[model samples]
Target: MKLMVHYTLKNKGLLFFNFICVFGFIIIELGLPTLLSQMIDVGVVNNDDAYIKKIGLTMLAVVIVGVLMNISLRYFMTRITTNVAASIRQDLFEKIQDYSHNEYEQLGVSSLITRVTNDAYQVMLFMQNFLRTGFMTPMMFIASLVMVLRTSGSLASYVLMVLPFLLIGVVAIAGFSNPLSRKQQGNLDRINNILRENLSGLRVIRAFVNEDFEEERFDKVNKAYEKSSKNLFRLMSSAQPGFFFLFNIVMAYIIWQGSIQIDQGTLEVGNLIAFIEYIFHALFSFMMFSTIFMMYPRAAVSANRIKEAMDTEPIIKSKENGVTQTETSGYLAFDEVTFAYPGHAESPVIRDADFSAKPGQTVAFIGSTGSGKSTLIQLIPRLYDVSEGEILVDGVDVRDYDIDALRAKIGYIPQSAVLFSGTIKENLRYGKDDATDEELEEALDIAQASDFVAELPDGLDTYISEGGANFSGGQKQRLAIARAVVRRPSIYIFDDSFSALDFATDAKVRERINEETTDATVLIVAQRVSTIMDADEIIVLNEGNIVGKGTHEELLETSSVYYDIASSQLTKEELGK
Candidate 1:
């Protein structure tokens, strides 16, 4: 949090200049009342019109300079605040992109989103207020207090009596507001979580006709946010009245003393007038400080939220002297590897799992849900580190190789067929940044996506809606496959990427991929037995353990799981047809 402040202030030099101008403007404002008092005492009371006009012009000049200074300060302050907010948001976004899965899980997506959007905005507002008022108020208050004391020590006693109580009031407010502010941010994160879940699962909700249920759930979160916000603002609202009440009591003391001095012929009318002006300046300045302090707790909570994300360091890192395998022969091996998620201490996801695929050989993993099929595939690209053993590529531990070099060799198509909102060509080119039109078409033809693509008016340039909502499920899946094929990676891992496609299209796509890249290793995780029936080797997973390993014929006789899965699917020729 301190570092964020340092970085924000360091980049905003104009804000500092604006701070100085504001400080000078406040000092000049304090003199206006004193000058008015002088005009009344020296010119008007003494019947000197020239002197009145002279002091009046001086007052006008001061007012004009003060207004101009204020306008200049406001301009710079707004610019500084806006730029700082943008830079902070940009840095935060970049950090999130680089964050590892472990880091993301630790800070839930809902909280991360809230911190990036709402919390960042809160910090910006606080900084704007801090620059505009934080510095000037305290200095002006203290300076006015000094003037009041110098004018009359007796009158100074009245302010001293009330100030201690005001300080105590502010301290009490800070203590209460701090915890409430933190709670408010937590509530906001919960609201974000609720909304994110609903948005992502909107299709399922409509399919099930559960809109009312989802709305009820959203209402609960919204009500919580409202309650938390009310509590925070309730505390803040009391600050103004509390200070005003105490200052009013001090004003009564001034009136009482002024009546006595008038009877004693000691205090002049102008002196009392100046004293009243000083009291307004001093009290209001303190009040401004109090208001700023009231907002500090909320902004501080936001800062802490943002700092938590920025401070995280990814678990997976590249070795300093790691070598890049520019021309990987596509040999992948897992040597006695063990891994588990952070909270699951029962057993490893891949418990001493061992396997190897030589260049050009096809390896398949057949598993039920939660059988660690995806986790096992993630290890090849160093998405996660092995807990107890090493995962090797080309006989070297993947962790010992440069992260960029290792990932570049493997093309991964996740279970979900995610597509960005852009042209079909743009999404396909992500795998190979320099992919030409010919390369895109070649890959699309292999993935069985070229037929539909060619039918579109723009062909490869047809726009894809968010998450490929414009296309069918199978179409999105094939495009994702095409995206992977365009990379021309030495190793391809399709993690249940073909589940949506029909058996005929799936078989044709796989055949094309095998034919086009004979030297590339293919690793697949699939639920359908037919998908991996003809692979060189298949490992069957159950309860995170590889219960069976054999060819399709060997598995049918030896493994119950394999036999049952095979019985559910059609024969190879039927599936191919």
Candidate 2:
């Protein structure tokens, strides 16, 4: 994969040094067997004790050098592999962060997490093994073959006959295992998806009394993953035994032939012993090579997955030389804006929606479910770009502005409040990194969260669990609102943010927000009629089109859709007042 090349090249100098150490180790390994032949033939045949001691000390010195070189090689390999893995992970995370909402939906969060973690680790394992055993195997095999030939040509021929079978078996195993390895990685993704879903939806599963059903669902994927893993390991396991068997048959032939040569006084016992040692070295190297190749298929699959994530180009990207507006007065406008998610171009979720809001004005969108009210407001910040027409903020096209600059001017609170795992102060500080204690208190006061926060042990210092699991739903929503308020942006968006609060707290929070943000544009998407009845202008939508656009009283008098929504939540006397 290209990602592998990109990271491996980062430590090329260290990697080169590591390979040099491998070469040195191979030299020592090949030299030891040759010295053994000399020790037996020249020293023992002539009964020369001095020659034997000299050869023995030389072999010990070579062994010590080889051990030291192996240590250095391992140290460099570990550093290279670990750093490359970290680099790949960082790059993958940055690419994922740049993905637009559409791309996020295309690649699910669970799959991306697995790719960043498990797949990256797989590549690291391959690189480390390749450096340690992979390069040494081929060099050792060639050197051992030459030594065996110098010792006995007949035995070399027997070893040569076994080479073709070993090569063919290795190739066939790799070919058959590659696709299965890919499938195994895919199965792992499925298992992770199920695991994530079950954990996130544990409450819902218990509420619906579907625990047994969820267990059954989990079992199916788990069993499939196990089966795939078992099959892949089985295929890889066969290579080692097959290589050993073929080399063993060649060893039998060598011994039988060497016995006849010795009986005919044509081969010395020392040469025959050395030739057997050389055969074992060659076979061991070939076996190690086979094992390395077995791991390659799985790593290749993982590398491809990592490449896919790194290569995905986000559809929403800033243009080169994108304009940056120096000043924002919170003037947001939608000019005949229409939008559809990536695949449903035939039918827009919001169609030809025209609206405008100025500084200090509160514009509200009131609609039934699936009426595109939330989708319309999201376009102002370019969460998902409009499919047709344009959205302008501060009289400049949103597309023309750098995305970061444009988003800096807006504070968006989604319908579902999400908080990271941190202390309350840390979560609040996410909006404005330099915010002071006074600012936090004021924001909490405006969001009607101050009283509750003061009552908690440690107050703002209290640590929140993941996703704010430690807090109630209403408390989480209040903190979310306070977080946005701390930003003090030009525009404040409350997307049904008050739904979790009671009517009284909702009324007080809205009043406080109005008092504080009188100079900033406020846009709200709410379902309850009471929440938006006081909006300066309310746009009522049905399906994908605007059904009414006017003040609450004007809509009640002129539009039945608005009237029905108001009457459903309030009595006639209340609506009249």
Candidate 3:
């Protein structure tokens, strides 16, 4: 609930005006009943037609004023609530941009999407109803009760007796609703997560022939969501009827007793009419308030989920006033770096890894599947910081540099090729925003992708589908390589990026890159030994430890781990060459 208030503060002026509208409307509404009593008791009793006309005209003016105030209140509420929802979503999005991979993993992507979209909508819905009824009802109830007590104390006593019961019902319903709301939201997260997985992995599911299994899995969560929703609604569905029933019974008693007082000449007919009006206002307010109370629990649950994401500070916080530039480029060193993921501190994925690369050098790492090859290169970009030691870039600790400035110096191509839904030009501009068309063509030539891209009718203007689904795996990889080459960065990192291409294309791309990167450092991570056989230096990793570091010929005779890997992938003729 406080989450809403925090954003609501941005439009305090509108809120004040909205409050004025509600107050003015309540005054007009309460005043009309009193004016009606005067018209009936004085004008009708004395047969004064002029007096009746005057009061009737006055009542009409007040009604018109009340309608105007209501219209104003509704306008202010609509603007403020919409603005607040937008602000909340925008801030939440900015917060998400700052998150490191650790936060992304901690808060699942599907759940985060739900929070931004569905949860934000829930807050907006609650605000819409709340602004309309929340302020009006309580003040209306108290003011009308005060008037009722003044008009006739005996009738006011009956209304007071039911106050405790109504209050008790509100508290009890809210208490029961909160837990159900929490359960329903949790189930919704599960359904979204399952849906995301099913869509993203549709090919794998079809390949394995598991459609029925997936359907059953989806149905399990759907039914659970249905059950929670049904229970919550059943409780809500029964409440209005019960309240209305109690309302009818109480109204009957007040009217019957008032008629008796009138017959005895103890109560004036006009006074009795005004008393009934006040009682109606008070009870009607309680009815409106009851609806708000019913919605509060769900809104409160949604607000808490949004607040949790807002409160989460990213684990990797760079130095506030960090260095923005360096004295040199294409120089990197990892000094006795040992790192585990955030939780598994005792079991490191990279152990005591000391390495350095200077300009004009090509360093390649080869290892088995879980040998931490890709993880090691990721350290250079500070994707995940080293747990135990520091990594230096251009003779400065990476942590001491502005994070964005540090990333700007390197062009990294991850193992998975990613392309957004846009023309090739837009995707290439992501690497270097102001890159010229000639520069783009040159980068594509270096990556060996210009041949295919030139075949397209639109060439650079050809639109890519989401995740480059329209492109072949090799084509996507080459485009990703071209994207990195467009940057002409100080250092280039290709983490198993060439695995998708054939040997000839891979070799051609590497040869062109070597010609292009004469002044920049290159780091390659690969599973294929042929990929790194011509490197300036090759490092072999076994488990988390670095077992070998040397040129191809040097490692073949000296390091068993390197020899075993090279011998399995290279033919005797190629090895000899």
Candidate 4:
């Protein structure tokens, strides 16, 4: 919330101007009822036509000013709110970009998405209401109370007696609503997570005819959310009407007491009328206060949710002593490296993993599904630091090297082929923003994605749906490969990026990448034995331990784990090929 305030102040003058306008409008609102009371009592009841006409005209003028001030205030407040929201969104997005893999994973995607969309929206509503009702309600309440006290102290005492009830009601509603609002946001996150998963895997769900099952799961989440929502509303519903009733009871007492004073000649009819109007104003202000109380709990919950994400410290941090390295020889080495995830104390994901890939050499990692092949490659990019031991890139501890500089030398393609919604050319250009059309085409050609791209009506201009849903799995993989290739990094990491391609296409793309990138170091993490069989060296991992390290022939002779993997896909005849 402080972060949002800092951004809001960047346009300090505009916001301050909005404040002046809002306060001015509040004064006008307070003046309107008071003026009407005067017009009715001092002018209408006095039989003074001249006095009535003068005050009546004055009231009309005040109304016009109030209307104009209201318009200006609304426009200015919107300007302030819009600018503030945009700035906060930008800063939040920029912070997200700095987050490491561990930090991102810990926060979880659904919660972050909710913060960006729903939570930010809540903050915006708070700001808008804060400027409008937040300021006006209190000023009006206090000012109206003062006016009533000056008019008649005895009746004002009745108004004062209602204060405790209003306060008590606000406190109770706030207490009950706070926990439910938090639960509501949490449930929203859960629903978002489920929806995200189902949408991403919609094809698989339909293929397996599991629509009913998924629908039932979603129905459970939806019902839980609905129940919580109803409970919160049921609790909040009491404050509004209950406060109205309490305030009106006080108003009736004031009216009855003032009527007696008027009949007894202690109070004039004009004063009695004015006193009643002031009571109503005072009560209305209390009602606004009650409304504010109702909104506070939900806004506070939303603020806390946003704060949680903003407070998360990135598990991976760059060292102060780190220096940028240019023109790296791309020498990679893992010396006695051991790493484990946050939980699972049984064994490290990659333990004492010792291996190296020299400049211009292709090193491949192959193993069973849970084998630490992908984990080992991730260490090279410093996605998660080694729990114990060192990883060296270009003969320097990877941590000692500047993160951006080290990453500049490495092109990483994850197991998932992620592409944003954009033109084919824009996605490719993400690797190297300054990449020319010729460079893009050359890289796409190397990845075997250019042919299909050219067939599309817009070619490189063709628009991709979110996550490249417009493309086939093979095409998405090829485009991802092209994105990595466009970077022209000295180290290329393919973390099973070729799995979506057919065997022949995968082989062709790998050959092209290898031939074109002679000076680059290639590290492949693949499930297929055939993918890495021709590598200069292969590391076989099983259950977080390096079970084997050798060439294909050497592995077949030395490692049973390697033999099992090789035997799974290869017939005796295919092995010969």
Candidate 5:
């Protein structure tokens, strides 16, 4: 809620002008009733036609001014609310981008998406309604009450008697609905999560013929959302009617008391009529205020969700005076590194891992699944900082280097190839923003993607579907490799990236990369024995520990773990050759 207030204050000038308009509007609205009373008592009762005309014209002018003020208020309110929402959305995105992998895992992707989109929008809607009438309601109520007291304190007392009951009802409804609103928001997150999961896994669902099952799963969440929504609306719906009922009783009482006063010659007919109008305005403003209370619970929940993301501190942070190095020999080293995922510190993922790779060298890591091969390489780029010891690039600790500067020196290709919906050229340009046609084609040629790309009707201009869904598995892998190659970074990491390609294509792509990247360090993580057979150095890992590190031939002779894996994949004669 405080965060929302901060955003509202961003356009103080507009808010100030809007407030002025609201003030003017309240004055005209509340003043008109008093003028009507004067017109009846002084003009109609006294039989002065001139007085009636003069008061009628004055009321018209005030009405015109009130209309203009309302228009001005709406214009400024819309501008402020829309801009504040945009700012909140932008800041939320930037904060998410800064979050480390830990934060991402803690706040799941589905929840983040909901906060950035739906939650931010809820705050915007509240802001729009709040500025439009939330502020003016209280002012109108108070001003109208004062005017009624001036006309007849006895009639105003009836409004005062009913006011506390109305306030108590609003408070009671808000208390009941607040928890329901939070539950509704949670239900919405669940619905979004299931929808995202279903859409992304459509292929797998069809492959397994689980469409009916998924539909059932969706129904479970959807129905929960429906139930939660109905409960919330039921509570919100009760407020308006309950308030109106009480106010109507108060209205009846006012008319009863004012009629007696008129008969006693203490209250004029015109004055009684004016008193009723002021009472309606006061009660109606309270009704509008109840709407604000109803909306507050949901907006408060949304604001808290957004604030949780903003408040999370990223675990990995560089030094304030961190070094920034653009030129390096591409020398990387791991010094007795050990790491465990946060909250599982007792069971370390990688234990006492040590390795190094210099420029012009190829280093390969081979291990069974869950042997921490991918986790080890991720540390080199500081994706997850090492729990113990340090990783260094050239001679500086990775933690001491500016994050962006360190990352820019390496081109990483993950196991899964992901591409946005855009032209092939656009995807390639993601690696090197200003890459030219010649450079793109060269990288494509090196990764062996040029042949298939050129075969397409539009070559580089061909559009890629989301996640490269239009391309074959091997084609996506090759294109992903080409994207990294386009960057020409000092270090290239292929994290099981060759799994999709056939033996021949894999061999050709590796050969071309070796030739092109003679001065850059190459690190490959592969399950295939053939892939790393010719590497300058190979590290064999088992259950988070590296048992052997050497050339392929050296490891075959000295390392039993390496021998068992090599024997499982290659024949004796094939291994010797």
Candidate 6:
């Protein structure tokens, strides 16, 4: 709830005006009844036409003022509520940007999406209702109750008698609805998770022929969500009829007593009319206020979820005034580094790994699956910190350098190529924001993508769909390499980036990279033996341990682990056996 208050208070002036309108609106609503009673009691009864007309005109003016105030209140409330929701979502996104991979895995991705979209929307709806009715209803109820007591203390007793029942009903609804709201939100997250998987992996699901199975899985969750929703609606629906029943009973009793008094000449017809109006306003206001109370439990649940995401402290953050500059660039080393995931520290993934590289040298890592080939390169950019030892870039510890500065020194391409929705030129600019057209073409040439790109109708202006779905796997990978190449960073990390290309194209791309990046450090993680055969050094990993290290020729003779991998991928002639 504090999340709502924080953003809402930013527009204090609008809130003030909203409150003023509500106050004026309430005054007009209560005053109109009083004016009607006067017109009937004095003007009509005494046969004074002018007095009746004057009171009628005053009532008309009051009603007009009420309408204007109502409109202003709604306008201000909408502006404030929309801004608050938007700000919360924007801040949540920026906060997520600062989170490391560990945080991302800790909070499931689909769950985070739900909090950003659905939960924020819940807050928005609650704010709109609260700003409109939350403030106005209580004041109106109290004022109308005062007028009720002044009109006829005897008849007001019936209205007061029904108040306890309504209060208990409101409290009961809030208590029951809260747990249901939480369950509903949790179910929504599951639905989103399944939907994301289905859309992203639609081809795989079809290939596996599991459409029926997937439909059954979706139906099961959907039914559970529907059951919860129906139960919640049932409870709310029943409460409304029960409230009106109590409301009618009170109205009937009040009118019955007022009529008997009027027949006995103890109460005038005008006072009875005024008393009925006051009673209606008072009880109706309480009902409106109760609706706000009912909304509070669900809104509070959403507010807490948003707060949890916003309050998640990113495990990795830049040091205040951390080292940003070094005397050199592209000097990389790992000093006896040992690493494990957050919960699997006892089983280290990369144990006692020590290595170094300088400019003009290419280091390649190859191993069987789950050998931490990709993870090893990720450490250079601090996607996950080293658990035991230090990683140095340009002789400065990675932890000591500002996070952004550390990453700026390296061009990293992950195991998968991900492209956003934009033109070819826009995607390349991600690596170097202000890179020139000539620089882009040069990078495309080096990545072996210039020919395909030139054949396109729009060339650099061709739009790439989300995730580059329109392009082949090989094309996306090459474009990814070009994006990195455009940066011209001091160090380049390619994590299994060439697996999509054929052997011939792979050779050409590597040949181009070798000749071009002579002055920059290059590290490649590959499973293909031919990919790393010409490297300056090759480190082989098995079960997270570096079992062999040497060049291709040297490893074939001395390191049996490297010999076995090379033999499996290369024929007798290629292995020189």
TM-score of each candidate structure, all chains considered together: 0.94, 0.97, 0.96, 0.94, 0.97, 0.98
Pick by lDDT: 1 or 2, better one: 2
Candidate 1 local lDDT, residue 217: 89
TM-score attained by model 6? 0.98
Which digits, one per residue and each the tens of the lDDT, describe model 5 over residues 1-577?
8989999999999999989998999999887988899999999999999999999999999999999999999999999999989999999999998888999999988999999999999999999999988989999988888888898987787788888888888888888888998999899899989999999999999999999999999999999999999999998987888888888898898899899999999999999989999989989998998899879988999999999999998998766878886456689999999999998999999999888889999999999899999999999888899999899898889999888888888999999988889999999999999999999999999999999999999999999988898999899999999999999988999999999999999999999999999999999999999999999999999999999999989998999999889999999798885
Q: Which stretches of candidate 3 lie over 4 Å from their true place?
A: none
What lDDT tens digits, residue by residue, belong to model 4 across residues 197-224? 9998999999999999999999999899
Candidates' RMSD to native: 2.5, 1.4, 1.7, 2.3, 1.4, 1.1
| CA lDDT, candidate 4, residue 103 | 71
lDDT for model 3: 0.92
Question: Each model's C-alpha lDDT?
Answer: 0.86, 0.90, 0.92, 0.84, 0.92, 0.91
Model 1 Cα lDDT, one tens digit per residue, 322-413? 97864557898888888987667576788878888986788999977888899999988978888888888887889888888888888999
- Model 2, 1-577: lDDT tens digits are 5667779889999989988999999999888878888999899989999999999999999999999999999999999999999999999999998899988788888889999999999999998998889889999999999899889997788888888888888888889889988888888888899999999999999999999998999899888889989988898887777777887888898999999999998898778888998899899999889888878888999999998888889888876787776576789888999999989999899999998999889999998899998888888888899999998889889999889888889999988999999999999999999999999999999999999899999999999999899999899999999999999999999999999999999999999999988889999999998999899999999998999999999999998988988989998798986
Candidate 4 vs candidate 5: which has greater TM-score?
5
lDDT (Cα, 0-100) at 467 in candidate 5: 82
Give the number of the best model, judged by TM-score.
6
Per-structure clash totals for the candidates:
0, 0, 0, 0, 0, 0
In model 6, which regions exceed 4 Å deviation?
A: none
lDDT of 6 by residue, 1-577 (tens): 7889998999899999999998998999889889988999999999999999999999988988888998999999999999999999999999999989888888889989999999999999999999988998999999999999998888888888889999999999989999988888888888998999998999999999999999999899888889887887787777778888888889998889999999998888888998889888888888888888888878898899989999899877888898999988789999999889888889989898999999999999999999988988888898988899989999988999899999999999876899989999999999999999999999999999999999999999999998899999999999999999999999999999999999999999999999999999999999999999999999999988888898999999988888888888889999897
Q: Report model 5's TM-score to 2 decimal places.
A: 0.97
Q: Which parts of model 1 are misplaced by more than 4 Å?
A: 259-263, 571-577
Provide the lDDT at 359 for model 5.
92
For model 2, name the residue pairs that clash.
Answer: none
Task: Write out the backbone clash pairs for model 6.
Answer: none
lDDT, model 2, position 499? 93
